[model samples]
Target: MTVALTTPMLLAAGPAHALLPNRSCGTVTSADSTAAANLNKVLTGKLRGSMTAYRLSCARAIADATRARGLPNQAAVIAITTAIVESVLENNPNKIDQTSVGLFQQLDHWGSYEQRLDPAWSTNAFLNEMVTLYPNNSWQNQQIGVVCQRVQRSAYPSRYQPEVADAQRIFNALTAPAPASKVHLEIVGADGGMWNTDGDYAAGEWSGSWASLGGTGLKALASAVTGNTMHVYAVGSTGRVFTKDANYSTGQWSTDWAEVPGNIQGATALTASVTGNKVHLEVIGADGAMWNTDGDYAAGEWSGSWASLGGTGLKALASAVTGNTMHVYAVGSTGRVFTKDANYSTGQWSTDWAEVPGNIQGATALTASVTGNKVHLEVIGADGAMWNTDGDYAAGEWTGSWASLGGTGLKALASAVTGNTMHVYAVGSTGRVYTKDANYSTGQWSTDWAEIPGNGAGATALTASTTP
Candidate 1:
């Protein structure tokens, strides 16, 4: 299974957003560094309170993340202003009140402690909710402080206004553009041990060699990233689910497995996404119904018990998110593909599942990636070959036929996108993993599938997630 929740892809059909001219992330400019260095001297007097170089950099991160989502300048102002009011523009990890933390003083309800403390992840989470609350561009007519208050539900709601001007200048200075980064990968290898490596998009190569995170009996897996913090979930042969945490920022991985709460046994296929306040999960439960659950995984808890999504005899789950709406796909018992939508902004789901019209049937694995407004769906067909199609949520349609991505004896599969190219990996009948790439710019795929080197043979299932 594959899920996409980052900013829209860098597409071949058009240019990047004007304010965020670069597709890269996590870069701060030399000029911005100088400005940050001078902040203590220049901001001795307060707009509401004084800001240090660190605080200014936090403001810049907030600004960059907001603009990357193609949101307006005012959205950045509102987010920065809210952070200033809540934490004096700091990414505070200490719980201040009622489990509250982060620059926005968000409680664990917003996410795990690590998520709130990650400036990039926290910024995206704030924007996710703001867009949801202000659906249909409603925030444009409201005051910036009012928008902040509505999203925050703060006890002291009036403080945000006094800091808006300061936030606006900070947002402007940091919105110039930044460098690029790709979502790094961790795979469950042939040995049932976890293996991870970093990728360099600029060099088109793995930045590091595959290294092992020792484990055994892991059959299937899914993962989600909140900045560099990764929460990995795996299903054992007996259907018991286990989770582990990896903080790439600090180069550490937890040595023990933690059982996720909520009696999530007998789950077969799984998918997860990083949303506004939590890591949302979709599992094909023991009863063959799609079940949903989410939580602050860093703290080892689910938001609640798993609730059924009510699909009959479903398998092979893959989901994608576009503009606050999530499109979930499943392969029904009869081998037909079905889909439903959840509008996060409105807190509603499509009334029922709709059959996707195509030659796609008897799918054992499904994975998808979003390029611009369209989702490119790939499936391993009943005939043991790969097929591709597109679902355009903006237009509310799916392709009537499937094109051949061209692989043979393929088993389980997963995909991820970086820039204009989509990378796909699949488990072959021999249990070895092979990959191929599709270039959106040239509408071409590698003529022959290339096997990924190293000890990844004998893999059973694969999952991939994208992070901004």
Candidate 2:
């Protein structure tokens, strides 16, 4: 029997009904930032006209709905496209349609009027409908038309095909191929920025700033940015590393500024990870050497022990870590990319730098997940283009050829990954952040970028999930 739900009951139980299966897009568990960059260029080019607003709103609504359910953070292209085809998301606002209204155009009689108008409620209902209809099929793999028909059963099912392509295009613009273990950060200003830091471990649509930690001449450059449960770590002026941690439980932030203890000519960049609650920070020391630390991110523990990973061409950049291996790559003084992977399991890091097949001038990023047997990397070419590399971390098979992903407005930025999709997000020189995703189906990148809600070169973290 169908149970009647009151407004309070429905609101309280919203998390159980969102679109994502198990409702959590596992943290950026795997990624292909290089592919993500390429797709961003493609999708940005595709977004235009009336389609732009509808597509954006759809994607935004789906993302919001997923978050409301406490489900894994999902990119919104699929549900957005579904709405684009179903209702064009343009029902009259002044007058109500008893049959359907809002983004999904839900029929009012099917549920409460309030629920029908709510973005989260509509998306959750749609996802639940899909699950009830196709309990065993893989929604991610099914053709768009097939998946849509399974849920909508529209009179002209075939008419929905074009929207599937639209959905796929948007999906590729949103889903990440892997996790963001390494991110490129560049601080453009000291203006306190407003952001949501509690979830996704990132700053979104920034505005306003924290209490000023006075340090003028805050020149920003491309540096490695990493995170832990309680703090964000980045390279400060003159190559010093700085950290800011929060005690959300206590609604407090540590005010003490502890400088990285290291004798260096200058610091280049920083990368870090949190494993079993311990924060690990890695950076290029003043002598053009690699330095690392293992300490309490919340309590501020950094040893500043310097470890030299030898190579003549080090241009201090970013690094990403998995299981026990840390993949470090950078743009050399000569503009070529030099990479090394530290395998903690063997108690030894790679002794020699293996050159990735391109000349990079910015930080390189990497990410991986269990579903894929590979690690993926992305870097900015000396030509200001983005290039990518994929390798089998466990099999020791490396693919080092560089492929060009074109974009004109991208600046130094950060990325995160999930599954076989790579989400590359970058701030435009115009101060707008853009995003695009690369999927495995076409084995190619989307040709445009979608505008994000805010600005800043800090980082654009991503995660994804699918409902049954």
Candidate 3:
């Protein structure tokens, strides 16, 4: 069945609120003062001489197709390497070789002109055949080139071998775990109104109707993607936590709000992370200490009562889970940053809070994400500037010095790492939304912030996640 892409409908609007900017330590970069810019760009259709663009376009199509079929990265690598050897990853409708065309030079027997020409469709068709040839998951153990050769039955079977390295490089670059797909964005309006975009920032639109599930006095909101579902959590006016679930494949949200079993104070900060099939939530309790709860998605139930993590004077908290290791960060009342580590496999949490070195102090809001073995953190400094610190979680070493990304009047902050790209969303004191993008592998951020439309004044909370 062909899935028709639909535009997301616009949601409800609300009144604006004045939010004070938090002071943070950092030097303002003149480049960051400019208005934000859009980073979403489609690379499909016909390809020219840009090898980088072609590789990215092919990788995206393959990734989407494989994901749809519930296939793994091995299948993606097979499809990409086949395309690289066949047409150098270009979409060539004009190329005529006994009716073969498109990225993989698929023949007429593959499908009709349109179907064969569509990057995603062609890749899907190729993968379906590949899976049929290797249904036992044995393809995972074979050389990528050999797998492609078996599927394509090309006359030059060895041609695919030479492109294996390049194919793997491109696949790794495009498939790195990202906090959210580059195409999706989640926003919380005043009065706890929630909205999300369905497509990429370049072409996606907000939902038409806002779910009135949230209430006034919503202090912090967070989201995480687990399998094919997106989970959103919000702290309502009554100091209670509410959650809503959405099926990313169908773009449908649950009709009612489910209250989480916890008693958090109003204005408490909340952060969420997902590893395997379990969802972890951390928040500042009424006692000003960090508390946590776990949601088992596989079991469809919450586990245990809220457990105290044993830290005092905790203000803002953020958590990141890489595999079974969960890392949590928070700003102490004295303006210092402290971290705790947990290993779920061992069922253990760090014994005590350890201050991050460099004497970094005075951060108001904190957000964190992990890529590989590295942990990246962004904080609202006391000087009202954005400060970022990164370290190797496995090695226990940090950069120590906080690097300034440069923005003023920033109130709320949220971040997600998708593929090899890192995205940070902030609601300025004016209540307008701005975003900055960085290549997570390079640790280089875009110079200017791009303003996201539709999120008008009074965007109190912001969270982001890629569709699973």
Query: Model 1 segments beyond 4 Å from truth?
Result: 1-180, 207-209, 297-301, 466-468
Model 2 per-residue lDDT at 443: 61
Candidate 3 lDDT over residue span 1-468, tens digit each: 998869887878887665323211122232212210111122222222234433455556776778788887777777878887787766777545788888788888889977887877888888878778888888898888788988888999988877776666666656554334444556677656776654354234444333344445666788877887889898777667888888877867898878887545553878888878889988788788888899999998887578888887788888887668998999999878999988999979999999877677888887887778888888888887788888786786998889889889887788876667777888888877788877977768999987775646677777877652
Tens-digit per-residue lDDT, 1-468, candidate 2? 998866664335354543321121112212323434444454422232234333344455676675566543322445666676666543222223446665666665547756666667778887777656766535656666666676766666775556655555655555532343322222334342212221132333323221333333332222222232245454556666665544434546566645555543366655655444455566666666666666654465555566666555355455556676667766666657777776656757777778765434454333222225555566655555566676666777767576667665444545555445556655555555566667754566678876553333342222111110
Per-model CA lDDT versus the true structure: 0.76, 0.51, 0.74
Give TM-scores for every candidate, taking all chains together and pairing residue i with residue i.
0.64, 0.48, 0.62
Candidate 2 regions off by >4 Å?
A: 1-187, 190-230, 246-256, 263-265, 296-300, 357-373, 418-420, 440-444, 455-468
Residue lDDT tens for model 1, 268-323 = 88877665545777888899988887786456568668878889898788887787
Per model, state how many residue pairs clash.
2, 36, 22
Alpha carbon deviation, residue 419, candidate 2 (Å): 4.9
RMSD for each model, in Å, please? 18.6, 17.3, 18.0
Candidate 1 lDDT: 0.76
Candidate that beats the other on lDDT, 1 or 2, i.e. the better one: 1
Question: Highest TM-score among the candidates is held by which one?
Answer: 1
* Window of ten residues with lowest summed lDDT in model 2: 459-468
